[model samples]
Every structure is written in structure tokens, then in C-alpha cells.
Target: MNGEGKVVCVTGGSGYIASWIVKLLLLRGYAVKATVRDPNDQKKTDHLLALDGAKERLQLFKANLLEEGSFEHAIDGCEAVFHTASPVKPFAADPQAELIELAVKGTMNVLETCTKVPSVKRVILTSSIATVFCPKPPLGPNDLIDETVFSDPSVCEENKQWYLLSKTLAEDAARQFAKANKIDLVVINPGFVVGPILQPALNFSVDVIVDFINGKNTFNQRNHRFVDVRDVALAHVKTLETPSASGRYIIVGPATVTTNEIEKVLREFYPDLRIADESEEGTSPLNYKASVAEKVKSLGIELTPAETSLRDTVLSLKEKCLL
Candidate 1:
């Protein structure tokens, strides 16, 4: 069969990133069987169903991230399986119960199921940049934040960076499982992802942009590399198509921005936004790095600039009446 005719399964199909992956897969003429927690929820699954090729190419399955073998039926007869489901809340009521345990269990469940699926040749895992570095790391000029670096698990619990801990441990577990069971695995570690909202519900990353424009952020002090959600979606598809794409790839934009820069950019497009002026809040002094050249060259992908990412985000939010 041709590349476009292959069947692929994407876990957590209703999620922010997963939703876009499902859309692109169907657009590429690949049959998609998407797993969601509740396929019957029109509020959650309607956007995916409304896609152009969804009627003929997309299938929805009721699956749970923590349920063992829940993904097998959806993944059956697929050449590739994309595992994008994970706990992403920055602050959890109970760190272990809400984030840590679920992340590891979900990763294990998906990888185990892949082992049993002989038809699955490749597994693309949607991990985050949180796995590559501590949530709060000491940065210096030219100190690279790339695939080679890993988060320090020892301090995440104390620092309240449970999200990082969850991703780091889960990715480590996946690598080990793939080695032992002989499963082909590739990891995509994307930075603070922001872009047009394709789903009915807002993702945590885009929610920050909404809050920024609406004057919800009272104080700001953090640095991040923003990547377009659309670009990230394409990256996942490219990884699946490229035969040489293996190991972990860090997906991110070209700029490192502070909260003030974000506000200024948003204000450029949304003059009526209530975002507070942080002119006095000088830009963060840290020169944090994201080593993306190698990955971009390898994938032959062009990244959208920060302005495009933020601009489309605001437009999408307004279009969706989210703002």
C-alpha cells in the first residue's frame, strides 16, 4: 500500500495536540482510528467528526489512558501509533495521584499494547520539553536545552514541578520498554505550544494566551520558547513518514520570550485587550537555549515565527468566541 493509504491510530484524539494530529492524518488520506475518553461527547468529539475526511477515514473509540489494553482495538492493523495522551496540569491537587502515577501508567499501557500489535512498526510519543530540562533551570548564555539533556527528577517534587516529573519519568520508562520489547519508538518534545484552537475545549497552553489578553495575569516571571501547534502537528506526521527519524527530537520556535514580550505581541493584534503593561518588568536576563537546528534540518521542516504563532492564536480565540 502507498504511504497515504496506511491506517494510523492516535490516542487521546480529542486533546489539543492529538486533535490536530488526527486532522492532519485524515487530510493526508490515511485512515484514522482515534481513541478518546468519551467518543459520545459531542462537545469533545464534534470538531474531529466535522473534519473533511473524517466521515470516511476517521473512527472513534472509547479508550482510557490508564486502562490496560484500552488502546489495542483502536491500534489494530495500524502501521503507526501516536501516543499523545498524558496528564498536563501544571498544578495538581495531589501530585502523585494526579500527575506522576497517571503519566507513567498511561505510557506503560500504550507501549505494552504496541508490543502485542505486530502490525505497528512505529510509535510516535508526544512528550514535552518538560522532559528535557527542569521546570526551573539555571540558564546561562549558549547553554543548550536539547534532546541530550534530561530533567532532574530529584528536585521536581520539592519545587512543585510535578508536570516535568511526570513527563521525564514517563519518557524514560517508554525508552526502556521499547528497548526490551523491540518496539520502534520516537519522541517529540515540544516547547510551550500555542496556536489556533481546533478543538471545542481550550488547552492549558492556549488558555494562558487568553488570560494574558483578558488581563488575568497579575504578575509574570518565566521564560519559554513558543512553538506553533500547527507546526507541532506537522512535526509528528513528518516523524512518522521519515524513515531516518528516530530517538528524541525537541520541537520549538526560534525565540526565547518573557511575559512582557508576549503581552506586547498580543497587543499588536488586539489593541482592545486588557493586558497590563509590563514595560517596567524588564526582560528576563537568562539566555536559555533550544537546540533545534539539527531537528529542523533532519525533518526538513520550517518553523513558524513567534508572531505568526501568537497572531493566529488570538484570531482563533476571537473566531471561536473564546475571548
Candidate 2:
């Protein structure tokens, strides 16, 4: 797992978490083949190139998750593959089918390509905490979820259900395939990923942060596990090197807080900024039940607190002029 001369292909190089993965890989001295939907887009690649060490080690390649053999070229000679490219849209027109297709097919495509190449040793999948817990209330006060717990797709129906279903099916597909093919797979199930936005664009998760900062919602009772994107990226890197880091790891922060709590922190830090009141009517974007401290810590990961993580996120957004 020496990254000095290793080649790593990061799917969805322009994405929020994937970009961080690519940056960390480059920093670790790995020659990166970043797969984008379109490598010709200068705007996207420009920001990546601006990062230190990216100029020499980074290589952008155009590959679609849906297309067969699309990732084959990008993955050639790669020793490790970070599959962080999965649909995050909460409300897709066909959430189940579309998510399933991308998650299962895309993973299969990556693994198939790995089989074609001799260098690939491991694949780190960016799964979500949603894959480990459901939106509904757990049975007991101590009903904390772990890597063993999986989101039940049968319970998923529409709208929000689609995203969860997709994650569940996709992760399940990966596990099944890994067992069958004996592919070295390490799954990192992170909670609501909150961190400084790498790109100027607002990604799917950032909509919640934007809504809170823009005074869009008013209720504050909901709570869920949250984690810093930087920490999650670090976990991916650690899992890559840790040969024993097989199976699933729940990458969550030290604490869970509601949107209202986050808003209060933002208002306190930036008094001039207008913030939203806690909302009571709308559905929560979080799954507050999942708690996998024992499991994640087993991998030697100490999560940052939610307050610290959210504060950093807000500061980052403000610095980037997004606030």
C-alpha cells in the first residue's frame, strides 16, 4: 500500500467528497486518474489543478457511470480505486431504479475493470450512514446501528425513500459481489457529510446548509449523526492502507445535533447573517438513530464533534463567499 508510485482512480472527481479524496491521494504521492463526466470542462478541472501537487500527479479522464467499459481506460494500471460516485439526489424521478442501476452497475463496472487490470488491489466504497440505518424510529432507546445493520429497501417507498433504497441496494450489491469475486472491498458508511465546500457549486447535501443559512426552515427538534468531509476523506485513505480494513466502517462524527442547533451556532458565530428558525412541519433530511462509535473506533478513528465540524463548515462557506 505504498502510495509513492501507486496509481489511484477516483470516480466522480468533480464531486464534493471525491474531490477531497483526489486531493488527499495526490498529497500522498499517488498518481491519480480522476474520472469525470466530462474532462473537457475546464471550470471543474481548474479548481482541482489549483490545489498543490495536483498538476503533476492528477490525470482527468471522461467516464460515465452508466456506460459499459467507460471506466476501463481510467482504471488501467491503478493499484487502488475509490468509488465515491453515487447519485445523492434525495428526490429523483425514479429513485429506486436509477440509484440501483448506478450503484450496482457502476460498482460492477469498476470491479470488472479491476479484473481486467492486474494492478488493482483494493476498492474503497463511499457508502452512507443511510445504508446502515432507516428513517423510521428504532425499537429501543439503545437501538444504535452499526456496520451490521442495513437500511431495509422494502420499507423504502417514494421521494426520500428512493435515495435510501438506492444506497441500501447499492451497498448490498457491492457486498454480494465482493464475496462472490473475492475483491478487496472496504466500505466507509459516513453520516451527513458536512465540511467546507471544495467547489463553488452547491452539491446535494449543501442544500440543507444553504436552507438553514438562508432562513428557509423554522423547526429544530430533529437530530442525526454528522461528520466532517475532511475526516471522511481521511478515513478513506486510512482504509486504503490498512490491509486488515476489510468490511464496513461507520465514519461518523463525535456527536449529533439538529438543524436548529446548527443554525444557533451559525447565528452566534456570524451575528450579522440572517438565519432560519427551527422548522416543525417539514421532514428531516437526517437519520438520527444510527450510532456506530464502537465499530468506527475499532478502526482507530476519533470523530470530530458536530459543533466543531459545523462551525468549520460555516466558516469555510463564509470564507468562500457562499454565506
Candidate 3:
């Protein structure tokens, strides 16, 4: 189907990734129904409202992820839906109430809405690599981790990986519901999403870079997977446009790098900043590999380089005065 005048809904449109999805959808000339927790929050919605084609093509609807039927109206008459709302906070006063319950319940709510809304043909869900992460794969021999691997629920429980557990369960629930109802569902499992931000608030992923710049001692020291935010947004667009796109696409960059390598690159570009050295204590080594070459290559999408992604992310944060 042509995307030109078709209607699509993007839940959590005010978020870091959803905002870019909304922007790209609008640029493609789609009538976008953007659902935010509070449509009246100008600070959050203003950037979306200011997009080039948003004046008439983009519509904001107030919707809550936890509310069962909240997404029905927003999704009505839309051909596709982008579910990007999920809690990703590192710590919560109540992990279950704040993160686990919300992620699972909110996903169920969206799935229920899709069932009720008949016009919806495809649902593109934004799931994290957490769902695919197996901190300790069973005596793994393979060098590259793909979409087949999954996080160990028991390990998550034991290690207090509440965030990973929440995303894993939510995605599992979404997939099960979609399959039972015979709905077309596509999931994008992204690693650390980093790049420019179109929203007013800073993205949590950016904090990893910010922490490194601000002399924070504790952060990911080993090689970690990352994908550009813009690449992630385009992956959503591709999934919507390409009917053959199905199942899960591990949307990570082809390369992985350590935090130290990133800091070195940043230091070369911005030497005046207080970027901390790797000599800081409490840094641990990580050994993991992820493969997205076949999947992303098949989709005809190219990812941004690690250095480019890091540089643009930091510059954008500085421009927004959030650095």
C-alpha cells in the first residue's frame, strides 16, 4: 500500500524514538495520529507540532498506556500502529509497580485495542534488545548473537534486571496476542538507541554518554551494541512500507564498541570538555556480539557509524542545553 495519504498511529509520540517515527511518517505524507500521555503538555508536543507537515497531517490524541481502551480512538481508521511506549528507567521505588506492571499491562492494552480496531493491518512494536539479551548464554560457542537468543527469566530475576525482565515479558505478551488473533505484527529490537533528539526532554540513553562526560565512574565499560536513533526511526518506516517485513529485526549497528573508544572519539572532537579517562575505578569488561548485517542489509537500510552517532548525540545535547 502506498504510504502517501494513509493514516498511521504512533503511541508515545512525545518520546525520543516515537517523535522521530512521527516526524518520518509526516515527511512521507502520512496522516499521523500521535498519542501522548498528555496532549496538553506543550513542552512535549511542541516539537512535534512544529514539524514540516504536522500542521494538518499530524493529530495529537491524549492516551494512556495503562488504560485498556485508550488507544482505540487513536488507532481507528489507521492502517498501521507504532507502539513505542514503555518504561526504561534504571531504578524505581517499586520495580514491579513502576516498571514491570506498566510494561506488560501497557502492551496488553495496546494489543487489546488492535483487536478491537479492524482497520489496523500492521502493528510495529518497539521492543528493546533486553528481550533478546542472555547475560550468560549457555556455554555459547557462536560469535554473533542474532534474534533467536532470548533473555533468561530466572537470570533477570536473580540479577535484578527488572528493565530487561519487563521488556521481555511485554514483548512476549504482544507476540502471543498478535499471533493468536492472526494480526500482522513486526517488532524492532534495538540496542542502546543514540543520536539526535527532537523532543524537549533528554533521552535516557544519552545519559550513558553524559555520565562519561561528567566524570561519572560507573558505566558500561565493555563493547555494547548501539544503533542510531534516526536509523531506528527509518526501520519503523521500512517495516510499515514493506509488507514482507515480519517477525523480529534486531536493529543494531553492525559494529560494537567500548565506552572507552567512544570517549576517545569525543575527546578528539571536544578536548575542552571534562570527559573522564578509563582509569576511573569500578569499570568492568563485557564480551558480547550482536549481528544485524543480514537482516538490516536485506531491508536496504544503512546504519550510522559509532563515532558519528556519539558525536551527533553529544552535540545535540549541548545545543539543547541539557549537557
Candidates in order have lDDT scores of 0.83, 0.77, 0.82
Comparison by lDDT, 1 against 2, better one: 1
* Top of the candidates by TM-score: 3
* Candidate 1 weakest lDDT stretch, 10 residues: 277-286
For all the candidates, what are their Cα RMSDs to the real structure?
2.7, 2.7, 2.4
Instruction: Tell me the tens digit of each residue's lDDT in model 1 across 112-218.
Output: 99888899999999998777666346545677766777777875656667888899899999999999998999999988889998887788899878788887653
Q: Write the per-residue lDDT of candidate 2 for residues 2-39, one digit (tens) a residue.
A: 57888889998889999888888888888999899888
What TM-score fits each model? 0.92, 0.90, 0.93
Comparing 1 with 3 on TM-score, the higher-scoring candidate is 3
Error of 2 at 173 (Å): 1.0
Q: How many pairs of residues collide in each model? A: 0, 5, 0
Please identify which of the two predictions, 2 or 3, would achieve the higher TM-score against the true structure: 3
Off by over 4 Å in 3: 135-143, 217-220, 272-286
Give the clashing residue pairs of candidate 3, or none.
none
lDDT at 8, model 3: 94
lDDT of 1 at 277: 49
